[model samples]
Structures are given as C-alpha cells and as structure tokens.
Target: MLIVEELHMLLLRPDGRVESAVSGNRLYGEVAAVLVDLALHGRISFSHEKHPTVDIVLTEPTGNPILDTTLQRLVPMRGKRLQSLVVSPKLDPLEVVVESLVVQGVLVRGERGFFGWGSERTPESDPAPELVLRSRLAAVLAGTGAPTQADLSLLSILQNLNAARAILRAECGDISARDLKKRIEQLTAGSPAGDAVAKAVNDAIAAAMVAIMTPVIVAATIT
Candidate 1:
C-alpha cells in the first residue's frame, strides 16, 4: 500500500465515515508521506544543513507516475525550502489518490450538495480495507515484533501526527492512551531517514502535527 493511501485510511472512521481528508492541513501530512516514500525509494535526497532550513534535491527518477510527477515539480525549485512543497492552495493533493481508491473499490465518492448551490465531494471508504488496516496497525503498534516498511510508514504517520491515541480509542474503546504512546515510541525508534533528510522530514511532519492541534493554522493554509 502507498503511504498516501494509508494516510487517507487513517483519517477514516471504521463505519465508512470520513472525519477530514480533503483539507489543506491534512493534505500537508499526506503530501509529506508521499515525499518520504520517494525519499525512502531513493528518488531524492535532502540537504538539511543549510543555515536557515532544509532543502530538497531530486535524484534519479523512480519511473512511478505519481512520484515522478512530483519530482518533476521539484526539479526547478532548487534552493527552495521544503516547506513550499507542503503547501499548495491550488491543488488538493489527496484528490487524485482518493479517486484512485474509489476506482479500486476501496472507497466511493459521493456528492453532498443542495441544488448545485454548495455541492461538495465526499469520500466513503469500504469497511474491509479499514478493518484490515486497523488490525495490522493495532497488532504492530502493540506488538514487540519488527515492523515492515508498510508498518513503519503507517506508524510514522501516526507518531508524527500525534494521532495514535485518537485512532486507537476510536478503534477500541477499552484501549488505554498509554498503549498509543508506547507504540509511537517503538515506531519512532526505527525511523529510516538518514541525517540529511531526517531533519526536513521531521520538520514537515512536525508542522503537520502542529496543524492538527490548531484549526486556525489549518484555515490559514486554505485559500
């Protein structure tokens, strides 16, 4: 599964309900996941030792359509701070990924509007995918086993966003918040990013997590 896919999955409720996945703030995290996936895939390198902030530099192409396209966008942006890529008012980064999920039968996109006045598109996920995802995460999160790439990816998102507690509580009401903290510590201990890119990725992830705590920041990122 793609990092973006799991990121979207995390925002969904177990009963096919979506909390929020199409916002600038949430998209920021989603985009960071995608970028991290690329970095992990060796399609780019990050130079974070610059005086002020971190910078992203593209490497060889991965030949994957979505990832390659993202790299193409970053090519001309040399010397640009990585933060710029995390914020894009003109595009909803999750739109294409959500549509792909809909096509895969994992989600159904529906319109919620009144007489074409204020129509908005919403996503409804299939419960099976979510159930599977939740089970894998719950097991790995609370388990003492080694985490696979997919598990690490999901856990990274959870840790960075401070979402483990909320997601676990939603999944299992009897679960304690302490369990979530333990899982985060476990997953964070195994981050695979090198020193060069680690700072950039961490900064991006931190910004996204901060946005989760502040709705005003979320609103600021929107048009």
Candidate 2:
C-alpha cells in the first residue's frame, strides 16, 4: 500500500538555506518513491489507519550483498529525504505515471496513449492529466485525501519491477532504491499488520503487473 499524505518537505539547498512546504501527494511523490523501492526489492509493506493518514513499514532486500552499506545510509533518513523520491533505471518519468495509473486501474491503455475509464469516453474522461494525477496521488499517500480512483490505479502499476522502477526515476526526483529497501526492512519490522498487509499489497501488485504487462511484453517480443 502507498503512504500518500501531505508532508512538510524542507529542502536544504547548497547555500545553507531552508526551503520547506507541504508537497508530494499519493500518486506522484510518495507513491513514486514506493514504486522505486518495490522495483529494487520486489515488494514493500506498510501500515494503514482505520481512516486516512496511516503509517507504513517497508521491507528491504536482505540477500543483496551491495545493499547492506546502502541501507545504513538510507535507514536513518527513511521518512526524510528518502520518503519523497523515486529511483529507476529508465529516464522517462511519464512512464512511471502511465504504468502506475494503468496498474491501479485509473487510466486504461488504449490504441493511442493512456485514456481515462468511464462509460462515456468523452474528452473529459481523463479529467486530470498524467502529471496532475501523479501529484494528487502523492499528496493522498502522504496523508492528504485528494486522490481519486485514478490515483489508486496508478499506484497499482508498481507491481511490476521493471515498469515500476522505470516510472519512479522518470517522474520523482532520483533517490537510491537499494538504500530505501534497507530502510523499509528496518522500519516495518514490528508493525501488527506488517506480514499480512505486506503479502496482500505484494499480491495485488503482482496480479496487476501480470494483467497489464503480459500483453505488452508479448507484443514487443513479436514485433
């Protein structure tokens, strides 16, 4: 599950200045970060409240030899710099948005690019552009509630490691996935719903990935 909520992001630029504000909703910033983490580790787990604004715990990669050191650097800052960034091998940020929305069930892949889902299929079908959807999702996951079905659909895209990671880097600011994975492992260790929620979220992500990517992959290979 993505932790989408409004957060106070305070960026300390090179010149010893402090820039702070509440940004990054569920679809864009926060969900983007989770997607990046999932690509590197294969799955993620977090906690949710009865209402919105739940705290989540992420699991890190255990076997990867190179991840230990990276974990050390990232674990301490899990909710800080690590929370609002994405990391991916690909450079197209829109890809992440596209994949996420498709997986989450918001925008469906049509003959052309992504199109919004509805019976009418009018020009207003996709009321929010991809960028707006991303931003809104990030805000919701951060504890804000501006998210719609579209935002949830986009988040579902992270179920695929390849697409999820690619989208992460393209859209959100770059961060280290290996490090984020380690941090999640340490943070989510003791939660009550840790194990069950992790499995559920992972399962959902997997199902969504197969549902969407199988066709695309087969077509690409054939072409």
Candidate 3:
C-alpha cells in the first residue's frame, strides 16, 4: 500500500503540479509501497540490478530544483542509483538520461528500433493523439492476458490501410472473435508485422476478458 501511494506522488500529473506527494514534507511509506507495486506490475522493469540506482532527467530544462531533489532522494530510498538528463527542442535529454541509466546498470537498452533505455538512433516525437490511442488500447489489454510489450507493439509496424482495418476488427470484434481472426489472417498475407499485430489483438482481447472475469475484493481476507 505504501509503495502504491509513493508512485502516485512521483508520477507527473496532467496539470503539471505535484499533488499529495508533498504533504508533510516527507515521503510516506505508502508512496514507496505504490512504486514497488508498479515495478511488479511490469509498467517498469529492473533495467540494471548491479548499480541499484535510478535516474530522472529533465528535458524541458525549466529547472525545478525542489521537485528534482525530492525525486532524487525519494527514488534512492526505494533502492536505486540516481542520475539526471536534460533535453530541449534541440537537446536530447531522453537519450542522455537513458544512456546514463544504461551505464549505471539501472536499465537494459533496447534493440535498434525499440522503446526503452538504449537505442542507436533517437526516436521521432510521437503526437499526443497517438500516445492517447495507444494508452487506451493498452488499458483494454493487460494483466496475465496481456501480451508481452513485444506482442502489443506490433500495431506500429502496419502501414497498409486494409491490413490496419483487419487488425482493428479482429481485436475490437464487431461481431465474432473467430470471424475477426479469419479476416486478420486473410489480410495479413506475408507481412512480417501481421503476426505481431494478430498476437497483440489476441492478447488485447484476452486481457479484456480477464478484466471481465476478475472479481473485485472489497473486504479483507482472513486466514
């Protein structure tokens, strides 16, 4: 519970203001608990276990020393080495931060074209619309039923119009899952990313099905 709360405080808010995390001028145990939960959930994974450090880079460069310092202290307490990266319209803070984390053994950089700590070339700026769409889709697909990030990311590889529609229908299911699967196979043909997208859609559907199957626990369980 503490880890859960700490993560809530550390994450950025839409309004750009640090909320309940600042309360009492001390990071509560609850906050730390929340972050741990996040780590377990796979939203974040151990990049490098050797250094035991975490890095928080500032790309905007406005310089919020208080926030930065608070995060630095808060993260190390949770067990990690910390570093900061600064990026701008011209500066690649993300790259710098990722590199530092990789060096410190806090993160495992990804392959040639992937999202994570390390990459040979910088990625293009993704628009908010794309981010929001991906997020919504991801929410509709997660948990045990959730595919590994690799399977879920296949949507990016598709560029053709028909193929995209087929994949969307299969995952979304306007009528039947079987029908959608059939259509997807028909559209996929020989495309490399097709299998990936198909896997993603299946995972997405499986994730949603699990959500529906799960029961909410409102009361404490006693041994």
lDDT for 55 (candidate 3): 32
TM-score of each: 0.73, 0.26, 0.18
**Candidate 2 lDDT, tens digit per residue, 58-176?**
44555432233333334544543212223212211333433444455544544322373332221222324434645664464443554443343344433223233334443333535
Q: How much lDDT does each candidate structure score?
A: 0.61, 0.35, 0.30
User: Residue 26 deviation, candidate 2, in Å?
Assistant: 9.3
Q: Determine which window of 10 residues in candidate 3 has minimal summed lDDT.
A: 82-91
Task: Please provide the root mean square deviation of candidate 1 (C-alpha atoms, Å).
Answer: 4.9
Best by TM-score: 1
Write down the lDDT that model 2 would get.
0.35
Query: For model 1, what is the alpha-carbon lDDT of residue 190?
Result: 61
The model with the greatest lDDT is 1
